[model samples]
Target: MVRVGIPRALLFYQYFPMWHAFFRALGAEVVTTPATTRATLAAGAARVVAETCLPVKIYCGHVLDLVGKADVVFVPSLRSLERDAHHCAKLLGLPDLVRAVVPEAPDVLDVDVDLEKGTLAFYRAIYAVGRRFTWNPLRVKRAAAIAWAAHLRYLDWLQRGAGEAEHDSETGWLNDWHRGLTNVAPLPITIAVVGHAYNLFDAYACHDVLRRLASLGVAVRTPTELPASATRAAIARLVGRAYWACEAELIGAAGCFLDDPAVDALVAVIAFGCAPDSVMMDVVQRYARATGKPVLMLPIDEHTGTAGVATRLEAFVDLLTRR
Candidate 1:
């Protein structure tokens, strides 16, 4: 069986399900690296220049972990997901960056995901990548169809789970989100954590930020979990137009959350040295300042320590509770 390695970084958190289903349908055993840790970050960081962001370094680490463990590593070049939309340099050149940095890596399977070319181009790129695993076009089509269904379902799941994030403290249903929080006041606060999932959800990159916020007895919402219509409308209203692939989610969701009265504050999680993140953070900060809503910008890097993140989160939550 052809063992395919998929790094658990970057788009992995967003598209891993579809990739898993696609590879499985093609009769390949999928090999994944363990969850992010300090060692993984360190190993991957040493291979790249110091200026690289935490997520990219972590991706390199994951690719390194897959060496000698799989026949090939799947690293898609996700240039643009929408028409006329462009991705940051990190995403557009991920496959090449891996090839340059990780010399010991096996074959890296990559497919261009630039939709600006046209709808047909999108299909062609996906099929071309599919052909690498199998020669049968019928099998590949079936796999693609299955993967498409799974992606839609995953999006639906994200929205459903996010919509249900509402808690009724009177009925005692808030206990579910009250884990790890004690000896502190039960402040009924909700915050929108705006950033890419790679930074917000990655344990090592952000020092388990989402869980940390939850443990502070605060409700959390992320861009990926928000409704598509609300986020899209917010984006259109805020900036008039956007050209970046993640703008709709990151910047749009931040705008939506900032304007939401139910949300007390907007907590922006970002990676240090990321150009896109810096722009998004600046936009969010300005909107927040204009509206008088509290905003906390937490930028994580390879040197970010757990104690520091914890202290900052605690301080931020304390400020929110006092507000």
Candidate 2:
């Protein structure tokens, strides 16, 4: 049985179930890198150029961790997920980038996923990846169908607030959120943390920011909780289409929170060296200033300290509670 290594960073958080299901259906053992850690980040940073973003550095570290443990690593080249919306250049060339940085790692299976080119282009890409394990096209189709279904289910879960379920990591109790369809008793304050799915949900990356907010007796809302229609509606408020697809979602979520009276504050998590996020932050800050809503622009990098983030968050919450 050949083992396939999947990194926990980047696309893994977005499409883990789909990728896991697809690979499992093809009879391959799928192995995932553990959550990011200081050591992992260090390893990644050492291998990549200093100018690369933190997330990309973390991704390289994850691939390094998979070295000698798997037969091949799956690093797809994602150009665009939607029409007229492209991914960051780093993500588009991820597979090649990894190979260049980590030559000792096992073979990397690179697949191109550019939906803007047309559905058939995407299908052919999937077929190319699937053919590696089996020659049967029908088998690949079945696997793809199952993967798609699981992907939809995962999206539905996140959109419906189901992903807010019990988080078992540190501060789990604080982050456990309401279960069994129970509503949270009106908290004194409600905050919306807006960012990409990977950064917002990954406990290691953001140091469990959501859980920390919950611990402070504050209600927390995230972009994943918003439905597709709501995101689109939020995007409409902007003057033009966002260049990066994920940035659009973040921008849209920020707009939604700004317009909602129930949302007392907004925290925009900005990744260092990400150009789109840099631009998005400017827009969000400008909007926040115009609306007179308290907004915190939290910028994170490889050297970001958890204590610092917590201190800032504490101060922000303290000020809000005093009002």
Candidate 3:
């Protein structure tokens, strides 16, 4: 049986289920790199140039882990989802970048999904991938559909679980499913978590910080969970200049969270070598200074030890509690 390796980074959060199901349906064994670790980060940083972004460096590390373990490594080239809605340029060049860094890399697959061209164009990319594995279009379609359905269900489950936890806590059901999932007992402190989409959601890579924070009696809010319209309105309310779309969303969410007395502070998590995030973090620091709210900036790299992270987290929480 053919073996395929999928790096558990970047869009892995958004597409892992679908990718796993499709490959499994094709009778291929899929091996995923273990969650982001100090060793993995070091491997990636060693392989890439010093100037590469932190996320990219981490991705290279994952690819290196799969070098001799799989027949092919899937590195997608996602340009845009629609006209003007595009991913960072670095992400679109990932396939080539990985190849350049690792000359002997397993056959890296390039799948481009440019939705600005047309919705049908995205589907064609999917079909093309299916063709690469087998000639049977029917089987491909079935596998893709099954994978998509499973992915949707999983997302729904997460959302439902979050909601139920909130509801159960409100009703004083402390011994229920909600209680075991989070440390939201008594009065939970609200915390704003900011970062790129991929880094924020990957539990292993981010050291499961959100769950850890919850266990420490903190409730977490992500930018993705904020209402789009509300965030836009808040962005427009900015006193002076405009902000980047992603930064604006984060700032708006922070503003909203800060307005509520229940929220204690904000936590900004950025990958070690992320260029965009480095700039954003500077902006966020300035924002925090102006607003007089305590902001903790945590930079993550492969060599990051959870014990150190937990120590920092405890210090931050202690500061929040005092305030």
Best by lDDT: 2
The model with the greatest TM-score is 2
**Candidate 2 regions off by >4 Å?**
163-183
Query: How do all the candidates rank in terms of TM-score, highest first?
Result: 2, 1, 3
TM-score of decoy 3:
0.77
Query: Which 10-residue window in model 2 sums to the lowest lDDT?
Result: 169-178
Clashing pairs in 1: none
For all predicted structures, in order, the TM-scores are 0.91, 0.92, 0.77
lDDT of 1 by residue, 227-255 (tens): 77887788787777776888866788998
Off by over 4 Å in 3: 162-181, 201-208, 223-262, 279-293, 302-312
Give residue 213's lDDT in candidate 2 (0 to 100): 80
Which is the better candidate, 2 or 3, if ranked by TM-score?
A: 2
The models' CA-based lDDT, in order, is 0.81, 0.82, 0.69
User: Following a full C-alpha superposition, what root-mean-square deviation does model 1 have from the true structure?
Assistant: 5.2
**Per-residue lDDT value at 184 in model 3:** 46
lDDT of 3 by residue, 44-159 (tens): 88987786766787788889889899999999987765355456668878998988988887998788978778867777888888777788878888878887886665455444
Worst 10-residue lDDT window for candidate 1 reads 169-178
lDDT of 2: 0.82
